[model samples]
Target: MARPSLREKIIESGVRTLHERGYAGAGVREITSDAGVPQGCFTNHFRSKEAFAATILDRYHERTQAIMDGTLRDKGRPPVERLRAYFDAITERLEAAGWRYGCLVGNMSLEVPEQSEVLRTHLVEVCRALTDAFAEAVRAGQDAGEIRGDLDAGDVATFLLAAWEGAMMRMKVDRSPQPIEQFKRVIFASILAPGVKAGSPQ
Candidate 1:
């Protein structure tokens, strides 16, 4: 089999490094070393660390989009079940990683938005794409009468992304799946439940 190109190696290493370490913690030297390439290769390929990070973020989002395509966008399953399967897939991956690395996008959202406009802009686009994917599934559920119709689909999708990211932060801090589990429980039981809507009294 052919070996990966230097650029692919750099991006592969950068994704892992940036996910494990925050944007500020992942240095060029570390990334190159992880890729088993010369440190100078980084500057040769990327304009700057910020630019490299933006590329890595894109790579990470591609993987996320693949998961979404497989589960969230699976028309074979009911929309609510597709949503559950999507999160279940993510949970399985997090458990496999021992819950150390939360998510590259979530990590970068906290660290890079304030400093790097290139990265911040890319993050915004990535987030919007994710929200749209979620919203698509949510709108389908509402149309099928499986999710509450009174609330706006876009709003629910935004809330799901925001709350899930927050739960991920707590999961990383606590190094447990409890936060994520709680998120799924509350979300499936109330927010996404086929009932009177989230804030309404039972």
Candidate 2:
């Protein structure tokens, strides 16, 4: 029941502020105001805006990873189903946010390069961790005959991440969830389809 410190408050509110406004739009003053702390406190706690954003990215990654772990690592559920559940959960999150904010890592990957390399490195870590989890899940599905194994799991995971991130960008551009839904439909039906093994032409 203890209160969050000023630094913690910035990171907590900074995550939402950055997600909503992006790197260029999210000002330190705005974040501090959202956190209910003075703007001057930001410099006292963090060296610069880039350093603050790195902390926010780490927090965001931990949160999304927890969600992924809950659905993807549930041994009782089939691996493919678990994959669907993970996307379903993400869809709900995007819908709840009125489709305004996409994944923090994806947002930063697009918006932050002009700002700082340090933060970009943090973004890369978030992306790699997500791909690793997806790859493991895909491998599990292949083992259980729930997903095709003709394609390398790592390659498939990389493709899925790339496609999904691109679709998320599309969603933001069009301000519609249609792109994400289409991605889910085609990806599940073709790539992750059960017992799908590519063979020679008949």
Candidate 3:
């Protein structure tokens, strides 16, 4: 097999750099050193750090979407259970990372959206794709009487995704798993429970 190109190697290093230190902190010199490439090699591959980070975000989203599909689209599990499995999978990864790197998409959303329109557009697109997957799972749950029917599945999914980002942020801040537990508890027991009125008594 052919060896990876210097550019590919730089991106491979950039993925770890971006994941570990975030966009702004991932300097070209650091990434090149991680890749064992000269600092000038980075300029040969990426126009700017934003461009390189965008590629890293693309790679991160691809892996994230695959994980989501594995759980959210599993037909053997009940629809609501599938949602639980998805969250569990994410929690395990976050815990393994010691609650750092909350999420590349969510991380970039907080850090880069204000500075670069191109990168911001990429973040928005990735977020929409993730939201669609959750919405599909919620719709399936509603059909199976596992999730509340009155709430619009799309809206519910949006809220769930939004809340999840917040929970991940808190998890990073507190360096604890309790936020994840609370998110699952409140979501399953109340928000997504069948026939439960949102923000009101059942």
Candidate 4:
């Protein structure tokens, strides 16, 4: 195997650091040191910490997008099952990390939006992409009669993202997967439950 380039090292380290520590909590010095590079190396590659954060955020989103592509976009599985599988995969990752670090996108959404307009804009775009992925699956589910048809797919996607982020926040606070499990339970049982159409008692 080949050694990672200096920029790659910094980005790999920055992704882990930023995920573990919020934007304000992660420092340039820490990121460089974690990468085993001098502080100057960060400035050499990235114009600013905010710029570096944007890079790492994109890297993080790419990982998530891969997961979505594999599961949410997998046509072989049932539409609703694909949604469950996606969350299940995410839960496994959270468990692997000991539930210490939640989603980077969700973490940054809470921390950096007010601090950096650059990051805020980037986050908005990232969120839109994520919502679109979910919306695609929701629309498929609706078409398959496995999701409520009356509800707008985009609206459901937006709500799922927001609610999942909130559940992750609660998971971090509780240091348990209960919150996440509850999210899946309620979401599957009521919100995304099959045949539960509009005006029907849920």
User: By lDDT, who's the top model here?
Assistant: 4
Q: In candidate 3, what residue range of length 10 has the lowest lDDT sum?
A: 193-202
The digit string of per-residue lDDT tens for model 1 on 38-62 reads 9999988999998888898889999
lDDT of each: 0.88, 0.85, 0.84, 0.89
Off by over 4 Å in 3: 195-202
Error of 4 at 93 (Å): 0.7
lDDT order of candidates, top first = 4, 1, 2, 3
Q: After superposition, how far is residue 75 of candidate 1 from its true place, in Å?
A: 0.3
- Answer with 2 or 4, whichever has the higher TM-score: 4
* Residue 115 miss distance in model 1 (angstroms): 0.8
Please write out the lDDT profile of model 3 over residues 1-202, one tens digit for every residue. Answer: 9999999899888878887888878788789999999999989988988888888888888888888878888877778877888999999999999987687778789999889999999988988998999999889888877787889989988998899999999989998999989998888876466564432223
Model 1: CA > 4 A from native: 193-202
Question: What is the per-residue lDDT of model 4 for residues 32-55, given as tens digits with 9 covering 90 to 100?
Answer: 999999999999999999999999
Candidate 3: RMSD to truth: 3.7
Error of 3 at 152 (Å): 0.6
- lDDT (Cα) of model 4: 0.89
What's each prediction's TM-score?
Answer: 0.94, 0.93, 0.91, 0.94
lDDT of 2 by residue, 37-87 (tens): 999999999998888888888898899889888888777778887788888
Residue 29 in model 2: lDDT: 85
lDDT of 4 at 73: 94
